[model samples]
Every structure is written in structure tokens, then in C-alpha cells.
Target chain A: MTSAVLKPGLTPSRVLIYAVLILACLMYLVPLVVMLLTSFKTPEDINSGNLLTLPHVFSTLGWVKAWATVRGYFWNSVAITVPAVLISTAVGALNGYVLSMWRFRGSQLFFGLLLFGCFLPFQAVLLPASFTLGKMGLANTTAGLVVVHVVYGLAFTTLFFRNFYVSVPEALVKAARLDGAGFFTIFGRVLLPMSVPTIMVCVIWQFTQIWNDFLFGVVFASGDAQPITVALNNLVNTTTGVKEYNVDMAAAMIAGLPTLLVYVLAGKYFLRGLTAGAVKG
Target chain B: MATLELRNVNKTYGSGLPDTLKDIQLKIAEGEFLILVGPSGCGKSTLMNCIAGLENISGGAILVDDADISQMSPKDRDIAMVFQSYALYPTMTVRQNIEFGLKIRKVPKAQIDQEVERVAKLLQIEHLLARKPGQLSGGQQQRVAMGRALARRPKIYLFDEPLSNLDAKLRVEMRTEMKLMHQRLKTTTVYVTHDQIEAMTLGDKVAVMKDGIIQQFGTPKEIYSEPANLFVASFIGSPPMNFIPVKPAGGRGRWHVPLATDLGQLSLPLAAGDADLDQRELILGLRPEQLALAAEGDSAVLQARVEVTEPTGPDTLIFVTINGTKVCCRLAPDLAPAVGEMLKLSFDAGKALLFDAKTGERLARESKTPAEGSAGNVAQFRGR
Candidate 1:
């Protein structure tokens, strides 16, 4: 495969293409490398050295400071993101199964309306959402943030799952039905098992969306319930005697790490899911 | 085992649209293999779906063992269907696919395992039990699909063109395998296919459908030799039955159909003495195999210039024009006349059929001497 891609002999054009690809890779990695380097530097090293240089004195002080400030909100993000991802994903699977397989009157229209949610601007709904949450006495709670993320994330998750299930032959459903499987039985025994790729896509998408969300997190949650993104912003914006650039970078990395870890772990499935959803849809 | 029946079954897409299936009536005795054969858009698949209760009938009842199952859900109907696409669950291993139905019925784990093993052994797919469907070849997947159905002893097995996706050679092999499996199980089965050869060979009873209506329903031999209409005659045979236009030839109580050749016109006598045959347009149908090279002393002989010849290995097909209608005659390869050669062809009038040209309906009603001693024909048409 590599020989097929590279061809037998390399021409100047091939060399040029390789040069451009390497340059593009370095361009993308520069910021990440700078962030890592900055997170390892002591405040004195950061002050003395250029941003790209290795720390003159490597230290754990930045990480310790960042963790002290961000740990509670990191747990809050976990508390909010996990249940939100699970509920939305489950709801998406059910919606996808019904819309694709067991369709009834107005199902297409119902799905159309659900898909319309994907385009609704969060800014436009944020005020009304906050008002409703306050009326329901769920404002400023992790549970409220969970509800917010799940509701907002459902459209995308359903789109992923519906497109995936649509590619599955309807004959499988009919065969299962004849095999004495009812709705849930067919979903559990047939549809769900075939859905690992799409589920991975949805969870990754929703996890990243909910975990990285600052607007909803800052607006709907506060103090003890604030997610890492909101907490990081507050920590970085605090007016103080001296700015802790290393701590801010460390804090930002901490805020970003779960999604990065998720992608790193399941990145192959993430890509497969996207392309599979595209082809099927 | 079950006796399956469709009574006045009708299916229409909606109130304004035409019916997709119209007044389909059929019966299959216990362990009988019924073949529903038709071209695309002929509702053969729809009838199979209706019988499986996957599609609801707009008008009538479906019965199994004399009990109406039209209202029952597909699962409650005790029917298993093998689809054209196989529909094997891609996520399941072969064993799990075969065991799925039993598991759904909440059968004990041990029994399910035993049934899966039995089916795997029966289908010769025991080695494939650990592999997912995507890992297997098409033929292997087909076997696993059959195993899934065979794992459960449903009242009936419905095969909707199950062999359609296989290559021609594998289809023939699987066709025989299907017959052998059915013989061992003795399950009532309904198979749908567009292939006339499968219809003829696999069916104990064959239903030839056209435009959502059954054109003919009879034993395979009966359908072959004594078709009910021009459509049935044309649809059921390979290289199809030839239709020659004929008009009354004389005023006497005799009728002759005209045949054309480049040399001259020849005439053949029609055995039917019905008065309605006079001064009326008619069509005479004869199967290609029924027309042969004329030998010395053959009674009904006509000379024609061969237009084309196709050698199909087992037999050569000779094409000639009769009354301006192209006629195909199947004959032994050695005796096949070359194109443009003058040839004498003889057709037995006893095996010939007549139909009303306008209505396309069969005109003559006479007892045809059964050429082959096929069991279904003997039992179903003995009195006729």
C-alpha cells in the first residue's frame, strides 16, 4: 500500500508534496508543543525564556497550582458530561430506530423538527433557557447544566445514529420481527450491537461539545457547580499582582485534556463513524 | 407442518392507487413446496410478505392449518422468511445468528445452543460458527441465513428469491441443496423467484403471476404443458413458447393455421373442431422443444428457411418465421440446420395449444396427455 501510494520513483513534484505535508504537520503541532513546554516551566523560566524554548528549570509547580484551582470544576464537568452523553445517546438511538425502521405518520416531519434544533443558535435560546431553569429551580446546578447539554446535543447525536441505522437493511428488522423480536428486542439484539461505530461518534461529539462549552457552563452553572471551562476562564481572567502564564496554560490543558484523551483513544472509530455516517446518509 | 391458504387476498397502496396484489388465492398442503414466480412488478414478493404477515392484506384472510393468521403479527404467525439480501445480522457470529430467534422466544440457553449446533451441522457451516457474517463468502453467508431459519421449526418457511444473489453455478448447486434440505425437514415452504427454471424444478405447485394477478396456478407439469393463457405460456418456458397468428382456412368443419417460409406458405391442421374457431383471429402456442426436425412419414410437416441458430451445448435453437411471427425450435445439436438452409419442421398438434388472440386467454379445453409422470401432476389433474 505504501509503494502504491508513493509510486516507484520519486519526482521533484513528489518531493515538493512531502515538503508541504511536513510543513503543515509542524504548523499544527507548534501550538500544542508550546503549550506543553509552557506548562512544564517555572514562573521564572517562563519570564526569562522565549515561548518556544525548553524550560530552563522544569517544575511541577504550575501543574499543582492549576490542579488546585481546577479540580472541583473538573469533577463538575465529569458529573455533568457523563450523564448528558449517556442520556442523549440513548435518546438518539431510540429516535433513530423509530425514524428509520418503525416509521409512522408524520415521522419524517417529526425528525425534520428535531433536526431543526441543530441549527438553533444557543445565544438566541440562552436567555429563555436560563429563565426556564430558574423557574424550575434548577439554575446554577450541575443537573441544570446536564439538562442543557443533553437537550442541545440531542440533534447531532440523533443525526449520527439515524444516518447510521438507515444504512442497515430494513430486511434485518423484518427478519428479526418475524423471529419474535419486538421493538426493544430488535433494538437491543440487532440494532444496538451494529451501532458501536456510530455510538462512539456520538459520545465523542457530545462529550467534546458539553465538556468544552463555556457559554452554557458559565451561564447555567456557577461557583461549586461550574465546569472546568468556566472555572478556567475565571482563573485566567482574575486580576492579580502577577499573571501566571504557565498556570493558565496548564489550566487550559486540563480543561482540554478529556476531549483530547477521548480523541486519542478512539480517534480511529471517530473517523470511521464520520465517514460511515456520511456515506450512509 | 401446515396447510397454508390465501383467500381473496388484496393489497393496495392507498385508496386512490391501484392494487399491488389482487385477489390472490392459493393453497399449499402440509409439506408442499409452492413457488410464486413472476417478473419484476408482478407482486410475487408482496404475496410472500403477506403470507409471512409482514405486509397486511387490505381485503382477505391468510390461513395456516385452517386458522386465520392475517391479523397476527409476523412473529405470532409462526413463519420464517429468508430474504433476497440474506439479512444476516452483521454483528452476530454464525452461531449467534442461527440462535437469535430461539433466544428471542426465551428458549433455554442449552436448547438454543443445541439447536444452533444442529442447524450448523445440517447446513455444513459448523466451522463458520465463530465468524461474523462479513467475514464469510456469499455462499457461506447464504448457508448461515438458511441455518437461521432452519434453527427454528416454524410452521412455514418463506424464501423470497433467496438464491437470486448467488452466481449462476452456485445458484444451481444451492437449488439442489435447498430441495434436499426441504426433503429432510418436510416443512411447508413458499419460494418466490423470477427464474422459470427454479420455478419449474423446485415447486410442487407453481403460481405464475402477472400484473398483481395469478395467471395460472397448477402443478409444474400442468403449468408447463397446459398453460391457462398466452402470458402463462410465454412466461413459464425458456426461449418462450412461440405464438403463430392463424385465421380460418376453409368453410368446412376443419381449421388450418398458416405458416410462412421464404420458399412458400405451408399449412397445419388444428385438431379443435369447435364452431367458434371459424372466421376468428386465434393464436397457436407451441413450446420450442415440441417442434423438431421432420423425419420420413411425419404427419405435420412444414418447410422453412432457418433465420438463425444458437447452440446452447445441450441443444441447438433454430429460429424460423411462421406467419411472419418468429418461431424458435429446439432440436438436437447434430441435426441443427445452418442459417439460410431449407429445413423441414414437424410439430405434434396434440401438444399444441390455442388461445383467443384478443383476450390472450386459452380457447381450447381438452385433456392433454401427460408427457412426463411427475407425481404432483398425476395427483392434481388425474380427473381432468
Candidate 2:
């Protein structure tokens, strides 16, 4: 009926749009579903004539073997990612606050130079960065990878925090100053508390970037210090043994789970932070 | 309470540019409430920022309680301000917003709690203590802003058009509440507003500024009755002071202004006359209340046809033309005249003011006693 279309219920156009959206979602989700099913499948079931079908017999052997193989690299990724995310986010926050609030001569040019870092491709900097890391006595170590990620990640994190904090009213800063709050007090009490959403966005972005990084892990770290991403690559491509597709799938899922969990946990704030126009002039 | 003084204050955004504030000078005694009123772009907010140490003055020293604080930061200046937008901490509850200043000062937790409760009860926002700023209405946010300033017993409080964002009725109510609060606290304060009514009613002293210059500074009564220039006279009144061009009549010693009305023309005697008056054109500044309904035997009455009538509850404004300039005459609602009808209007010659037509300055006048009934007329007009 015409009333049905006019009311809050679905119309023909709505159904069409929903159908397209569902198709797109399913297309994107197929790989994740296959990875999850294969991680829980025995090697025999994976090779059977049912690539798209659910596992007829479930097994944890693939997961057990994958965990045993990549556990050390998994811990290395954790060690490299946590410090990189924290240090980059903190430095970005201070840089953002100064750039937005305590502007001095040539601050805009400085921010522009920092923004230029975001556009520089890793391939362009790889050789020089490795040389610099060797001179600094940090090459082929997890610490070297941490240093690289923090340095590269700062450009993106600083951009996010600066744009976010620019939307905060200057009057709030002035008010806090009048209330006897000096630099750090104002930052800790007024600005930082109001920065929860922006921090979520920055932290999540940095976490995912550092966790999923493969080139930095391979070039800057070695056998004992390489992150899980590099180890997973090596494990999957090694042609010396039987092709353990189930084990490779399980290791890939393990490498991606942390970032997926972070997105799921803080996705609402992520969206709001992306769109909030916090203050009017 | 403290005396605040600004000596030869000057501000310019950059070299080779016109100054935004020019050699401003003002002084407020302890516990005095000074209102800075002007139209938009008048540098009133700029002046407020200079006084609050939010903006450094390019040229002078600002002193509080006889101590020059020009070099001190805003926090060290020991002053509080209420911004026009309220500027409440969005993430904090009302109680937390009020306690923020004291907390920053490292006040004890017990004292902070007591001060928060006191201001909440004083502003009648106790029920809203746990609510965030976004959850509150505009008026509630305004009270929370005021409460934040009030919680800090600073040397001076600055309010930069705090009630400007409120609706008309709420503005009026808050205006009264502000006056009452000021009376109770007796704290030295400077308030900036564009509303003339607020300037007239709330200020112990009013400073009118325009184009970055202080046009006049005095009590409200002096500002209304003895304005120093044409701009001050024109800016301070509602239904603004009417200006009619007039030519001098009679000899130099005894000047009269000839005004054209519906009844041909009439010459109103000037209270002050000078030898140079006959050679220069003049403007006559008259408030609407100065023009009244003429009695039957009134000697100096000008007849004019009413162009329009606006009844504003307590009184009616009748618009008429004299010398081709539309003039508004405030009369009681009972005397509402019909449009296009001729009415006899009498001008109070003793209350009339003369301005130089060329420079917009008040012409020198001979000393004369103040008008008797004008005070009562001003009271009646303001009572509405």
C-alpha cells in the first residue's frame, strides 16, 4: 500500500538498497569466514571436495601447531606495538596541543612539514632508514622496528589529534588559564579529559598500523625479534614440507585478531571522533 | 574587592595596521560595576581581553588593587571570567565544573566541596550538580557558567555578554538576577554588553565606546541626560534620540530653532545662545518622551500628522515628520493617535540639546538649571 511506503516501514527502494548492501557485506566477509572455518578444520577436510562447505570434522591440531610456531613472534609483535603506539600517541598529543593552542612563529610551516611525512612512501625511505638504524646500533632488533613505527606513525597520529583538538574552543583554554591552571594542569585536567574520543581514534589507528606492518618487521628485525606478520609470511610461503593450508590460515587469523577486536570494541567512538565538530568559533 | 585601572591601553594586530583599541583609559573603584557597551566591532571584547590578561596590551599597564599586573599571566592575575558561550567543560558535571578552579588552586577537598555546594545553592542549581553541561538548557548552562566564576573569590570578575545567547524573557530575568547577585557580592566587576537597557540598569558607571575610542564615561544618569557627544546620546537610548535639522532664527544673542510642522512652522526658543550660533547650522536632539501631548492653551505647540502608531503595551509611539525627518513621540497608550490625523505636540525647550551639524559634537551651552519634569518622564519610560 502507499501508506506502507510513506510510513517508517520498508519501501521497494529501501529493499533494493538493503539488498545491495547485504551483497557487498557478504562479499567482504567471505575471506574471514573461510579463514575461521579452515582454522578449525583438519587438513583432510580442507582438501576434500567442499571448499565452500562447513568442516565435516572439526580439529584443533592446526591451531595448536600454528600457536607453537608463531608464539614467540606473537609476543615480539606485542612488545614492538605497545610501546610504539603509546609513545607515538603521547608525542602526537603534545605536538597537536602546541600546534593548535600555543602557536608561535613558523608553527604552521612545521605542521606542514610533518604532514609531508604521511605522503612519503616506505619504499622511498627504506634504504636510508636501515642505514640510519645500523649507525644507531638498532638494526635487526625489535627495538629498531619500534623506533621506525613510532617515527612513521607520528605523522598520522599527530594529524588526527591536531584536527580534533582544533575544534575545541579557545575560550575553554583561556578559562582554565584564568582558573590558575598552568600548562600541564590545563592539559591534564581540561584538554585531556575532553580528548577521550580523539585518543581512541589515534590509538586504534596506530595499533592497527604497527600490528599489521610487514616490511618494517622483516627489514628491521631478524629471527628472534621479527614480528608475527613477517613470521606468518615466512611460514606460509615455505615449500619445504607438506602444504599445511589449515595451519597457515590459523596463523593469519591470529595475526589479524587484535586489530579486529580493537575495532569492534571502540567502533562507536571511532565514528564519532571522525565526525565531531566540537566547538563553534 | 579591588580597584582596576587601565592606563593608556593600546592594541594593534600588526605593525602598519590601524589599531583595534586606541589609548583606552578607564578606572573602576573597589566594588564598582562598570558596563562597557557598544555596537559590534567596537573593540569592547578586545578591551575586556586586555583587562583579563588574555590579550597583551601593546602600550599600557593594567593594575589591580594598585599592583601593576600587566606582565603577569591570566592565572597569576587572580581574575575570573564568564564567557558569552558559557564555555562549560562538556565532559564534567555541574559540580565538577564549579570545583575545577578551586581544584586547580589545590584547595582542600573539603573546602572545594563546601564551595561547590554554596554556589549551587546560591544559584539554585543544586539539583543539576550531577548533570553534564550538554544535558542542561541554555539558562541552566548560563547559571553554571556564573556559578563557576562565583566559586572563585577573585579580585575582579569579567562577564563578556554572558546572557546574550538567551531568549528575551530569560535575558531579562537573568539581568535582574545578575544585578541582585552583584548587589549581594559587591565584587569589582566589568561587564560588556550591546544591550542599552542592561547598560542603563546594571552599571554603576557606563563607558560607551565606538571605533575603538571611549566616547563617554559616567553614571547612567549623566550618560542619558548629559551625553558628551551626538554618538553617546544616540547610542544609549531606546527608540533612540530624534535628530532634526534646524536653522537659527532671530539675532545672535537670542537664537531660536525654526522647525517645519503640519501647522506651517514654529520657532522653539533655545535655552543657550551664542554669538557664533547664527552663522552655523545646528541639530536638535530630543528624546521621544520630551515630546508630549500639548494642552489646549499651550504656547509653543507644533502640529504634525501622525505617520504611524506602535502600541508597546505600556506606551504608544507615534511617528510624525518635522523638517522632513521622521520623529517618534512617546505618549501614554490612552493617547494613541490615528495615522494621518493632525496632533499638537509640545517640545520641552529646557530639555532640548543642540549639536554641531558638521562634527557631531555637543555645542557649548550656557549653564541652566536641570528640567523639573524630565526626571519623572525618564522614570516612567524606564519603568515599562
Show the lowest summed lDDT stretch of 10 residues, model 2 chain B: B375-384
Candidate that scores best on DockQ: 1
Model 2 spans with C-alpha error above 4 angstroms: A1-22, A278-281, B368-384
Question: Which 10 consecutive residues of model 1 chain A have the lowest summed lDDT?
Answer: A272-281
CAPRI grade of model 1: high
Candidate 1, residue A84: the lDDT equals: 99
lDDT of 2 at B322: 97
lDDT (10s digit) by residue, model 2, range B34-151: 9999999999999999888999889988989889998898988889999998889988999989999998889999999999999999999999999999999999999999999999
- Deviation in angstroms for B191 in model 2? 0.3
